[model samples]
Target: MTQTEKYIWLLNTIHRSRGRGLSLKEISDKWRDYMAKEKPLDRATFNRWKAAIELQFKVDIKCNKSGGYRYYIANPEDIEDDKVSKWLLDSVSMGTTLMGNLDIKDRILLEQIPSGLVHLAPIVAAMKSNHRLQITYRGFGSYFSSTFPISPLCVKLYKNRWYVVGQCFYREKWQEMIYGLDRIEEARVLDETFKYPEDFNAENFFEGTLGVSLYEKVKIETIRIRVEYPHAHYVKTLPIHPSQKLIVDENGEYAEFDITVRPTEEFFMEMLRGGALIEVLSPDYVVEQMKGWVNDLYNVYNRK
Candidate 1:
């Protein structure tokens, strides 16, 4: 068999093994026995072939993640459906599209997400069942509480992280809540099914908010941001928010933009991460909130 054929066979074998990592000895033994009557593979040749597979895929195939030297792709299944597999592979290959200008390490980590999808299955199952899930979430600013009897609407990916948007019983209304799959310690599908409101539209649910939390009391307001030079170049192509409108200043050598969204904590944290490269210039409340957050950060750091 050619290298491509061998690689396909290898991927199939690994996928058949399920979540259990397969050992090199086991793989080599099986390959040798299975192809003995046909194109026999020697031990040394098999090892080289394995190395080539790992290098081509950029996966830690030989890494000792499962106690011993086991071959495991980031995702167990090398999906055979040409269309679906191509789209999935393309999503990871085109990381910049999913995560804007990610660094090498960030890109590699993002690619590892498919493996983590193993955890997302339960959330999906829960949603399908019309049951609730118990999750511990720590957002960018705050952390606390379990979402009891949360009416799960859908699961989505933003910036390569999986979040389940659902209704919080505590809040007494449909609210867009984002819980990272990795942070979700435990999830249970309740026997009682929730009656998801027919009027609830997942797409428009959090349309006004920057992240997930939406406050009904406040309306989505326009806020302007100024990005200092050099980084301004990054902003031109990759915007901070979809609502952003860019305005270039010839003499200032900087980029200024405005976005209309509910200024939630998550929204403020987005600007905080941008540091000095970007500054929130408008909406007195937003500017004050940013200052308050900076003061809180100073208090925490100054003591230590």
Candidate 2:
């Protein structure tokens, strides 16, 4: 096996052996079985691999001296909490799992997300160096694209799409704007750097909003909704938002839920997608907005 593959195998093996730490002999046996070759790892080689894994993956593999020197992940919580690290591990694990089942490719179906990967590396580099980025972007509704200089702040992923949120110099003032990575035609790291605002917290900035689109002066409020039948069960099992709370569970037919968030266009669209399955219970303004949306839809279809 290649070095990268060996490292991934080692990581996956150790990660799976968490809590039930593995001995050198146990790890070596698994490795041999995985590679389908008897290549026992020496103490020096094992130590090197362990150190490299920690350095590259930020995964701490510690040895328990009392338990006959068994090795396992020392900071699994760190790995779980870090989104980037968790995603990397998940992708690697999925890839490794799929590699072993190549013959059943037809059985596996996956969504093809837009190629936002091209700009991710450059944007991340600019963010790290506190440099502004010159990006050429085209909105879906726009006929022509435009280029602008922006102070790269943070990148976010939502609904299988990547977005870069930053400060854009427009109309003689700096305004916070979000650009879909897929919509960006090109991006260049500018030599001119800008100081990222000390008070700006990317996580907190997005906490009140549903998706990437955040309005400048929108109010965040508690939104309550009632979902009916089977769909209510799904919503209960997999919440619509992180702030979701079960207000009332009317047996099984219907249930009321509450979430504290800004009712943005995306959130409204999500409610619309739920269609007959859900009904907005409170916050009269939101109920009115939903009615307006339904009326618009009705108008479009009812046109003669």
Number of clashes recorded per candidate:
0, 0
lDDT of 2 by residue, 1-304 (tens): 4566667678878888879899999998876776565588778888888888888888889999999989989998988898887787778777777777778999999888898679999999999999999999999999999998999999998888999998998788997899999999999999999999999999898987888887758798899999998899899897888899999998768999999888888888989889999999779998898898889988999996
lDDT of 1 by residue, 85-176 (tens): 44444544354233334445544542445334555787788887777776655444556745455667887676667777777755565555
Name the weakest run of 10 consecutive residues (lDDT summed) in model 1.
Answer: 93-102
Clashing pairs in 1: none
What's the alpha carbon RMSD for model 1?
Answer: 13.1
**Mind sharing the TM-score for model 1?**
0.53
TM-score for all models, in order of appearance = 0.53, 0.86
Runs with alpha carbons beyond 4 Å of true place in candidate 1: 1-89, 92-116, 125-149, 171-178, 188-194, 249-252, 295-304
Candidate 2, residue 182: Cα displacement in angstroms equals: 0.9
